[model samples]
Target: MNAHHDHTGPHGASPSGDALPTGTTGFTDEPQITLRGPAELADALPYTLGFHPTDSVVLLALHGERGRFGGRLRLGIPRSPREWAPVAEQLAECLVEGCERRGSRPDGIVVFLCQDPGEGESGRRVMERLRPFAQKLRTACGALDVPVYEALCLSGGRFWSYCCPDSDCCPPDGTALAPPGTSVMAAAAAYAGIHVRGSLRDMEARLRPRTARATVIGQERALDAASAALVHRILDTRARKDVRDDTIRLARMLVDRLAEHPPLADQDTSDTRDDALITHEEAAELIVGLQDRRTRDRAAEWMEGPEADHALRLWRALARRCVGAYGEHAAAPLTLAGWVAWSTADEPSARVALGLALEADPEYVFARLLHQACNEQLDPETLRECLRGEREARAQAGTRHAPGTRATARAAGARGVRRRLRARVGRSRGTAQGAPSTGPGSARPAEASGPGVGAHTGRRTGRQEPCGTRDGGPGGDPSGAGGADGSEEGSAR
Candidate 1:
């Protein structure tokens, strides 16, 4: 969580009592795949789970051949759910694909580097995104027949970067370099500096093909516990001279030990909410139970099979695990299982999952990363320029148009149009004309005017005109020739 460390997690912690986890795996980012070829896939028992042994310990293998083999570390960056939201989505997609190709889900995935170096807060936002990602892989992989049987969160961040990389044993590009998710994916692949001595069984064929396998160290007790829960009591009495019946019978039986049976919580049936369908406990429980390759594969199938509709729900449920410190993000486990689905199978559901994550927590960087990464992929330079232009335009517009100015603009435009119309009408109606006539029944201005009449200067009354009459109005003079022989209105016209 500190964003700079090589070892500091319950996961992948050293067997020794050292406060900081230290192992030969070394604090370094390794290329996910340095080996990819027909031979690699062909020799790999093609979908077989791999285990690697070192110093009387074990690590998971990404790919395999007939017996077992190992592959490079598939690493990625942990971005703020807000800062890297859309990009995070894209990153998830890439990781999912990469995992599938690995022929196994990630033996473990580090979703985010603990921001709190002392305490990683794999918070709700983080796990919310992760849970569905895992469930989706399981569901889609089932259809492909490419199975990822075992998966779990492997080792978490180590405060490796804080140390001087110049130190002979210091990790390369791990704690010292940029976070693995973004930079490593963007760059070419590189192997971890810590060399590995692979376990080779001397089973010789003319073509001694090889692949990678991993066995988790220190997690055996937990894994074995899960294994017992998963392994059902199946009786195959018909076969087996070499395989003894009830090997359990040979061992001493403890009368007091009772089988633990956690009740299966019924899934929600209504399905009305916009949130993910699965409960947090459900996703965690499913992930916890998936301790081995076979179980892992089964979980994946459960996701895609008849339970496909619940895939989103399951993801949502699992993501809730991130609320506490131990799960800040559910990346460790989901990443481990998703590798095989990523590389070998196509996962549309998983790819679309970023949107769901953002919906759950828009401010989360993991969600934002989806859109950003996607748009950048479309055209990075163009999008940047466009974004800048849009920002500037918005800034300028803010000054020119105050809030509520929309109504003002409309009013002003309307008023101006009305004024122009009024002026045009006034001009057509003749405003510059002099006061003209008084007729038989109307008051008139003093004027002497006829059909081809005179000017309106100093005219006192219509009676001044030739045809003006007293009956016209008081303003008219009785004997005035204002309209002497013509109708007053005609004269004015």
Candidate 2:
């Protein structure tokens, strides 16, 4: 999620994060906030401290010549990574000072940490800062025999616990939604009730004029590359089934007449793959860029590893997308089974390859799209019903799926909901000779309505049982007798 590091600056929010670009800064006279040396601790802090999940860490640099609680300050932000060395160093110094002032040395310091509006879109500087901090947290805790564990592991159940006990998290709306565990970052943020704040593009407005001045700070090229890559990847997935994806064609049309060549073509095709819509290299690359190095490496290896289940999932996703894109144009021989086999067409085959890629790496979103296709096919009522069970479904997907954590918690909270429904089914069943069940995964217990043993005593004829027990169960009168003519099932029908 993307949210600027806010602070006690605007709207009672804490203004944290790198300054926004000073669009059209006239008379550029301020010594262009350059690093003073090859690279020192102060220089690297801004960039390095950006690594934690957003809101987990905050980076602030206290600067000034006379210690007047001020200086030409530049808060580290997602955009700070371009000139990461200098910003990272400054941020580290700040964190170090914070800890040292309290008679302690920081294991690591992050420049800034903030939400980036959507999943994994935390500020670049936040992630950069966190990269070193996580390592430091791990190293320091492990070395000191401090019973090291992720903040999530400890903070859970005790939602109010926090490293910055003195500082306020987002304005508390309610109690913590998540307990601490492996996902300490998310747990902490959730505890803060901090939803993704501000739009990614709008994040600039959140910064102070002083900090906003850094928006145009030498990151044009990197941002261009990042933006292009991100936008293209997103549009490319429009080919998935049922999607009216005009992104690819529209994108091609937009740039076809441009003087510029496709930079991606020249940059590095080694990581990009053709034929298949997705690739192991691409999967790993996304992981590296979006997640951590260890996670990236692990994902890369899994993309090529053996796992039939993973392969099947990928295949399903790709097939759905290919069919969606091909629409009425899909022409291919079916398998002997006469069912559509995925590995037949360019798009579908790509799905097949994607599935293979997933055998090694299962978290590929495009692959995940296949399942989305299935989800889309559901009716609104059925879909809502499925979402009612989203937690259980996600949990069944297992620990490999981090997104499932919340979903699972939600499901666990609703434990035994089906039992209540089963009780209703049993009640209704007692009223009919045998009645349809409403319980999950349980078939209706109704017997086939045979014409021989009983006549149709439905309200159609207003001739249900006239007497005996209630409905047409064993103790009840036979159909066409007593209350049987006016039985609940008959009335319902």
Q: Which candidate is the best by TM-score?
A: 1
Q: Pick the candidate with the highest lDDT.
A: 1
Model 1: per-residue Cα lDDT over 376-402, one tens digit each: 111122222222333344345466767
What is the C-alpha local distance difference test score of each model? 0.25, 0.24
Q: Runs in model 2 with CA error above 4 Å?
A: 1-253, 256-493
Tell me the TM-score of each prediction against the true structure.
0.18, 0.16
Residue 138 in model 1: lDDT: 37
